[model samples]
Target: MERLQGKPFPAGYNPEVEHVAFTREPLYFAHRLLIFYVVVKCAQLMGHGFLLLAGHRRYVTPTHNLTYWHRPCQQEEGSIKQPPLLFFHGISPGIWFYIPFLTRLGRGREIILLEVPHIVTQLSFEAPDRIETVQSLAEIFALHSISKCAVAGHSFGSIIAGWAATAFPQHVKQLVLIDPVCLLLCLPDVAVNFLYRSPPTNLFHRTLKDFIDPSSEITVSHALRRHFWWYQNICWLQDVSCPLVVALSSEDDIVPSTAIHYYVQRHYRMQEAVKHEKEDDAGEMTDQSNASGSGRLIYWRGIGHGQMLVSLKAQDRLIAAICKQAVESGLATRAEDIKNSGQKNLRRSRVTAA
Candidate 1:
């Protein structure tokens, strides 16, 4: 058997070597060794299969489950009106991990936490399928009258959110991407290899094997293939029209700040034009300007990919910005509609006067 050793990589110092193979030893106790290996391997496979099944079933909110906790918005009075902010949790772990952030945001907005399909119950897969699954969930929300709301996603969830916004442009008025996985244009090969090597399960190569398994690989690939599609999806962001708010963490190990900055600057422009347009129309169009100020990009200095949503302060800031942006976008969109109506009225008035 070959021993795995630690090595320094771009993301961090990992103790495991990349692509090391293990073999069953042959000796006086060959029969015992074979039995032990088979037992261990079977256990690993069973565990992975169980997780895969659970993850697939729990990925989305069940349509039949009716109980959902609700809290009135802090910004509103007895009016009881709050913009829905759809949230997507990151990989591994589970949505319950975000209770801190969710509790904070729940104080003001009706948060729809869309769990990534099969993340907890099944093996991870490629990015495209994950995107498709999220898009389907977004459509479900729209079918239930969840139109013109702010959509937020973190890490891998961010990629899903981006696809959701792009796929259903009318449903998502604004987007809040927190330390997104796909925004990074280029990642070091070492980092990508490190991510793949870790492979959720450390006891055996179960997670890795399941992910590569042809029978169950599609969903697993969509969930685990983040590094491969990072650049491809970032490039695809150029086609998204809805205003975006990208909150990046400088201390993220999984994704570098340089990559986030590049995509935000290159593709979305960090709301510079929108802000400028708002400022330009400030005097003549106060409501319109306020609405145009919806798009924003925020950079948090010392937060990691996982810690960004765990912090109370971070959650507060994120929720506040998202709520404000949603309101502003709605106001702006409505103002434009009204402006068009006024233009039509003026045209009629002119014809009548003439």
Candidate 2:
């Protein structure tokens, strides 16, 4: 993995990812090897079928280290040219868990899915650290000529997506972070590590714990906590100029709801302060109504960290919020008009049937 040359990383930053160098006794090694094989097979079976149906295309960068999957819209050039949506999945084997949401979200626009380099690499080696991964993702975006997009991330992916907005604010029109972990104030590093490795309480987390590469997950989790722990890293959101929506689950076990609330409150308060400052100066705020640069926070009840992606109610809420933001920011046109038009058509059909 190549470090971002000509640019300095942040203080105390490590350029490369470090893996656990535990000596593998034959029996233990074989056991782990078999488990890994089963995990990979399960991921392939569940995820590949959806990708085939969606016509998903995976491309390896000319440099080979950076690769991503693209699922183009089946029908483009609609009445409105909506901005494309890019997804960063949580800590799962792949984006297989999100295929349902991605398929639905890709209705009229293209969808791009990014895999963690370490997880996707065929070689028996770890990939770059968080910072390099972010840079690599930006490289992919630029390579594809995607100047503006709606970037969304879930769980671990949220941190990457957030950094993407901060790193390439010029290119991101909107950012949606769902069930983000370790972005806000949280327990100590020891507690975080313990909870991450603890037994899963549900099927979703169980799948994540089992399928994801353990060495990579542990490495990234600790590195991210060290690098991006609330005050040190997430506070950078204060500098993110794009419109942001943070969705939180009140019953989340991995990330405390209090931390999420703290982040949302603090961010909006700061935005409000900025708005007030602009008002006092009698200067017009920049794109005040644009969804590309606003902060909106929402809380959902009963949804856990994993359920948010699969729950229909949760998904509907997220989709509605996105639509509302897009309509308000003028990213999606004729939404209301189209809905009303569709309603009229439905009513006519019912009457004719009667």
Candidate 3:
């Protein structure tokens, strides 16, 4: 009997035979087709299972006016002074998908997971209260006594991170963005057109149903309903002033690299504005004085959008840089210093507006 790749088969099934058997051929074909179908079905089932799990609530925090669910970080004992890292998840299979990565990062540190409303619900894209959602989150943090923390967001979540940093700069000391969706840069016309023309209903039903399962109709509708929030996120990024560390995946297909570069350039130019405004004001410092230039753009070669979370090597390097900056900023002052700085900044902003 001949073997296929060293696995022995029955004598009649050998490929070296002069003639193929009629009865055996049909059986072989059927077996191959069955294997293929089963593999495909398993893959589909797995995808749907992930989507459903992503929608499940992991942590719930309630205040007087709002209620939200977030993934809680796994904390180690005796780590009181550990800095808090807030993670804002992306648009796909919810934060649950990144549990392994988050669990690793959360060890010996404080981590807060922020959940965008309607993420897995049927109203995902119809975020009429988008701004209020973020504001409420900020208030939640304040109520929870999170004075200053590192804010990190992935993809669509980056928009939220950027907005939070700008709206409440005092609270967010470090900003980390991964494969951010910079809508301002030159986007492929087809992609942009697709985003503009496709209603959330059609998009949710088509893409989610095809990739996930037809039975995931409710989940699909919920994710699609939040499409408007994605649009608002673009505007939020433009006005962000916090020191930012952006990681761009070299192989990202959903977000173009050009857009990322454009956003960095725009923010760099804003840094220049800070420099110009301070020219010889004596009390004012150089452009480098602000932590914004601590701003960095890191490119991860061969990493796809989703893989960045799971890549141990990539996460190590990225997290190290982010934590280093956070520590430096944190050490520069005690708790009182942070409070005073916040008060001074508030007064300065009001004066400027007047």
In order of appearance, the predictions have TM-scores of 0.57, 0.71, 0.61
When 2 and 3 are scored with TM-score, the better candidate is: 2
Q: Candidate 3: misplaced stretches above 4 Å? A: 1-82, 121-128, 182-209, 213-231, 235-238, 269-289, 331-354
Span of 10 residues, lowest total lDDT, candidate 1: 21-30
Across 247-311, the per-residue lDDT of candidate 2 in tens digits comes to: 88888767767666786788788777777777678766667423323577879997766787678
- The candidates, ranked best first by lDDT, are 2, 3, 1
TM-score of 3: 0.61
TM-score of 1: 0.57
Candidates, ranked, TM-score: 2, 3, 1
lDDT of 3 by residue, 1-354 (tens): 345468766455656543322222221100123453355446535643553464423344443244333333334433323456777776644455566676665555556666554443222343425567566766668656788777788877777777777777777777788887644533442134323233346865655534443113333333433234344556344455566787887887667765676667777777767666776576666534466555677788898766887799998878766655655544223345566779999999999999
lDDT of 1 by residue, 1-354 (tens): 123436544467666654421111111110123453355346545643543443212233354322122222344332223556777776644455566566565544555666554443233332335445654565457555676666778776777687777777777767778877666445552134324333445645665545332222333233343333444345255555666788887777667776667766755443446556666776344543333344566777788666876577776777667656655555223344556778999999999999
Decide which is better by lDDT, 1 or 3. 3
Clashing pairs in 2: 243-292, 243-293, 243-294
Model 1: lDDT equals 0.55
TM-score of candidate 2 on Cα atoms, chains taken together: 0.71
| Candidate 3: pairs in clash | 121-222, 122-222, 124-225, 124-226, 125-225, 125-226, 125-227, 126-225
- Shift of residue 326 alpha carbon in model 3, Å: 1.6
